[model samples]
Target: MKNSFYLILIGCVLLACSTSKPEVVMVTKTIATKDTIRIANDSLDYEVIIIDAGFSSWLDSRAYPRKYHSLNYLESKNQLYVSEWNNRVLQPQLYNPNLYEMTINYDPMLRYGYEVNYLIYNYMIYFQNTNKQKLFGTVPTR
Candidate 1:
């Protein structure tokens, strides 16, 4: 199962590489096996595919537990983080294009349930910490 997920991550990375759009930084290292986390809500038609090497472990160990924060708080934080992330995506010359690869189309009006918001909020925290990028509020530490 783990191997399969890594394969999927590799495939996604390869597909991204094949894009005609030029990247600011070209890094062509044969990706070693890495963790790929897929969070999906079928009824809501939302899916988050995180293809980072240590993300899964960090999430489990460092991220706040589910339900630790209110849904409203999570939603608000996600909105801020996603907006910042998208802005960074637009300004690759200023920010690392590799870190902000794609823009997140997160609708603030939509209620993606607690689980979705929780993961997103935590992922933003993880992303910020790993990249040394600070978002709106102080990131939670455990």
Candidate 2:
């Protein structure tokens, strides 16, 4: 009887020891590429190269539809938004004055295209994002 009790106790101890190991879990993180520009005690950062608020809106608008618009349609729509932003930049603006103040040279804004418009557009986006403020009137729903 004593030997049987010892055998059961040993079996129980072995079982407990066998099941006591902790599980190992592996986690993966995504690293995004961001671009940053610093000038004279000022810092600007952007996540994407493209920067038009209208283009951004159009980009978000495509998520639910999951369809691509024609190049003409996209260009025209984005151009409208870009022009609106350009006009706002020309006049006195209410939101995020630092963005305008820091880089408020409008002499080159005469030409309205991807390169010229997106430069200031990117600056506004970087300023807004860095400051963590939704100073812009429009917010993308998606």
Candidate 3:
């Protein structure tokens, strides 16, 4: 009887452990656009893939002043770019308030006059956390 009771207890423990579910994590944001901007490693790494649109000319015009005036500051640092364009221009219209399709990349170390990039970065962070939570069943503490 004693042996039977011990076996039953051990089996119950194993069953409970096996049946336990991992914690659920939630991703707060979703990246729907391929041109979505992302910043990683505390903004040391930046990538901007602009969708195919007429925005490139606009970005070039706007980014030129920053590039020329802040040459030393911009040099060797990761600069923002469109999907295929090599120049950075800041066209006010490129960041169309009406068009929600443009993608932007940003560095936290650098600030642009545009508020859209800031919004994109925050949105990405939210999306990343939410995604991690979904995958691991728990939101990352970070």
Candidate 4:
């Protein structure tokens, strides 16, 4: 089996304060290879990249199509997942540092559109199922 690659995208930090909204930091090492799963909003100039080698193929074969999950459902689940993921990132002692690498900055207030939310939501699901870890409760089944 091929080893899965993991890279921290360090997605946008959606700080509520007006003056300190940091832009998304793109990892220069990886660039946009076919294996990378990227979600970008040009207007906002914020982007997210999931650099898991297995994610691309898993998303295609295992995950349900975008239509299967509604925008609200995706956003809501992402809220839960991102919050827990960030928590795990903060406390590496408790959670595996390998599984929870970096903090994901996702703001419910800022609309990331359907595609962005869809990809992020599915990525979390893939992450949990593949890693045999749960960002929330149980490992979600497709």
Best TM-score goes to which candidate?
4
**Candidate 4's TM-score:** 0.77
Q: What TM-score, over all chains together, does every model reach?
A: 0.70, 0.30, 0.19, 0.77
Model 3 clash count equals 19
C-alpha-based local distance difference test score of model 4 = 0.68
Per residue, candidate 3 scores C-alpha lDDT tens digits across 25-94 of 2122222243332222222122222232222333333233332334333322213222211121234354
What ranges in model 2 sit over 4 Å off? 1-67, 93-95, 99-140
Instruction: Give, for candidate 1, the lowest lDDT window spanning 10 residues.
Output: 23-32
Q: Give the TM-score of candidate 2.
A: 0.30
Expressed as tens digits, the lDDT of each residue in 63-126 for candidate 2 is 3232233434434444444445445545555644333322122222122223323332433444
Cα lDDT of model 4 by residue, 29-57, tens digit? 22346588655555556656677777788
lDDT of 1 by residue, 44-106 (tens): 333446666777788778887878889889888888887887798789999886666666666
Top lDDT hit: 4
RMSD of 1: 11.0
List all candidate RMSDs to the true structure: 11.0, 26.6, 23.9, 5.7
Cα deviation in Å at residue 51, candidate 2? 8.7
